[model samples]
Target: MDLFTESGILLLPRDTFLTDTHVQLLQKQRIWEVEVQQVLSEGTTENITNQLMDLDADKETVAAYVKALDKTRSLFDGIGRDDKPGLEQFSDVFYEVAEQSMKQLGLFRSLYVLEGSDSYTYRHSLNVGILCSLIARLLKWGEERIAFMGLAGFLHDLGKMRISKEVLLKPGRLTEEEFDQMKQHTVYGYEMIKQMEGGSELLALCALHHHERLDGSGYPHQLKGDEVPVECQVLAIADMFDAICSDRVYKDRTSPFEAAQLLWKEACNGKLNIEFVSHFVRYIALLYVGARAVLNSGEEVEVILIHQDEPMRPLVRRSGEFVDLRHERTLNIEKMIG
Candidate 1:
């Protein structure tokens, strides 16, 4: 076992036999556990079992995710047919499930690689809602504001419900005309929420502007920075992130780590808010420090350490030797397997 300090200093090298003096040395360093053969910690090494669940459903983690997803779809279907679902009612149900999903599990654990395309939009909505709450908490927003952030995220893609199955579920890339038509959902959603009796104007605005990029490159209104509300900015990051982490009909999914890298790149290119992206990237990287992942090369690797400067490029251990992803240009983390 290799012993390290609480601050990650190498106090005792690997292969050293455990002795009374070594135990005292570890105690002095305030180290609780050693990195056994450089394997990741319990939180990540036991990742398969760490999946967040909706305890109200009394099901397994995957089952709970499916349950919440189906509930969201049913609600959207109500909206599609002009049922005019109640905003407070919807928020109540959403808060119940989103809150349950976060129980015991740390933030951002909702970044799962979904297998099918049938439930993408609604699942994306819930994922974004959950992620928004996390981002709000990270930003030190108050409880009520954080709840509003989550509700905004849940309703941000509500406009997509008006889109037809043919266009929304197209197997490949959308035609230019189809893409333009798809973009109308943002506007459609804004009007839908605006007509609701108890809906907040901020929530309606978030629904409309969630697709608006910071550089005025986004569609519809072509909004730019400061023109975009901080609430919508949080929704934008969460929306883009869930979309990337999920498997779309036109493209395969990227790992949360890789997706974070993509979000960081977009932020760097001035498409996203840099302040939010930087904080979120580091938060994501830190969560997976002891996690297991599959690389693009089809090799299984264990994340060992997160680089402070370049968080996306973490040090991973495969088989035994350590590989610094920052130095390896070709191999990239494809997705988490455990």
Candidate 2:
């Protein structure tokens, strides 16, 4: 039998036999009961029964995420058809998810683990929006600013709707010409936002400059350092984190641990906001403290502690033995297996 949270997150696929660890996870989440199918007589009858189980207790959060993703897909489809969806429409889609993000910190932080069949653009938009809001709160921003930041992140990639399907969905490397066209999404998003009712200059600029980096390597205008608005700086960090950590058409997803390392490196190289990266990456590393991961050396390890000095390199337990990643520089987490 298949198992899923009330919010539609798949916990166990059909025919998956539950293990003790699975039950423990479910119990930890407060999921006490689930419906399962029992087969009898080799095809004569299938019986459905309520069985004991347990898991994370964020059905509301996961459900809100699933609903927001659906709405995002519809909104993006409208944009593709040249239909201008207003700020109110985007807000309606984001508020529920944003509210959930504030309450269930555990399940909300692991939302990416519930990836479904939704297209990349729609899912990325929603994830980036949630992440941007989280980062804003981490900065101790007020409620009003946090809400606006979430909206800005939701609309950051609106320009991609204008790109042709062939260029957007190419399963392989893009040619130089195609890549140039792709970069125009920032400009297109800026223009689209400017035309929307109630869209402010900051919102429009966020669409335009979210890709702009501190080192002048970004596209659209190459704005650097203070030239890029602080709001856009926050948006850029969320955008890059989601893009790197989530699966895309041409690339597999990298684990959040490795993704944080890359973001930290970019910050140190003057390409990203160092302060933002530092706070965000440390939070990300700490979020998975008890999560399991596979190392480059093929051993599975459970994260035990996050170092304050180097959040990306934490202490982990492998086969009941502790290994400090800071001392073992050559070994890094390759993927998250949980």
Candidate 3:
């Protein structure tokens, strides 16, 4: 059977039989019921109760996010297609968006819970930009630097426009040659941004090197350690986190808490900046305290405490007992119900 959220958004479309994984995906996203009909309507639902939470985003924030995504999609499609898109027009909307969001509390909350998961390219670009701005604010960067990071993130993937739609949107794994070709998006982005009227070298560099790793394991250049610019390193973390946490064609979306754990692991492995990842992980844990979540064993839990040393493994309360995830290494906050 097919399933959809109350918003009438497609969840699992008309499957002959739902597998365990499919059921798990729905549960993980906290989706409960779906409508079925011989002729599915573009019509609306009555008094639908959204299963998502206030922590995800307030109405205004969600509306703004939707507008930003639409704008990003428009700009991405228009830019370089005949010079109809002005570089500053993109930043005019983008930088203002990042700056305006600075006034909100839980600035990262909306970033953690965007809908329309299939709109990865458009949504991911905007989310990475929003994440970059949030990180800059957390780091106490100057306004100019914060805006610059947002702009860098907003246009980071513009080079993907040069790729063929088939290879870019393939539902399966790409062959090695195709993968190599895919990596060229970084260079393509760098070159594209460099020639744009209003972009700077720093912006272009962020596009080029956001994929580079701290331990020299990244693509485009094997630049290691201090060689990688801090901007690029920060962007790299943001990009990777969004990619992991957000739904993609081949995978279901992982919860923000689980995504934090993966980020922490990479930091420990030296693939990411420890300072950035550690701070982000701690903040994420603290932000999700009192959140409702589902453990992998299909048990519901409430996060009660964030362990300073192991932020990824927060203590949770379930069935009147407090369970320390740090001790129960196998148990995880698989999905945040909010």
lDDT for each of the candidates? 0.78, 0.81, 0.75
Give the per-residue lDDT digits (tens) of candidate 2, residues 262-289.
9989999998999999999999899888
Tens-digit lDDT track for model 1 on 77-150? 67876777789867876887677666634334444633545467777787789889889988889999989988
Superposed by TM-score, candidate 3 places the C-alpha of residue 304 at a distance from the truth, in angstroms, of 2.3
Pairs with backbone N, CA or C atoms under 3 Å apart (clashes), candidate 2: 26-54, 26-55, 27-54, 29-55, 29-56
Q: Write the per-residue lDDT of candidate 3 for residues 113-213, one digit (tens) a residue.
A: 54434456777787789888777767888988888888888889888877766667777899898888899999999988888888788899898999898
Q: How displaced is residue 257 in candidate 3, in Å?
A: 2.2
Q: Candidates' TM-scores?
A: 0.80, 0.81, 0.80
Instruction: Report the poorest 10 consecutive residues by lDDT, candidate 3.
Output: 40-49
Report the lDDT of model 1 for residue 151: 86
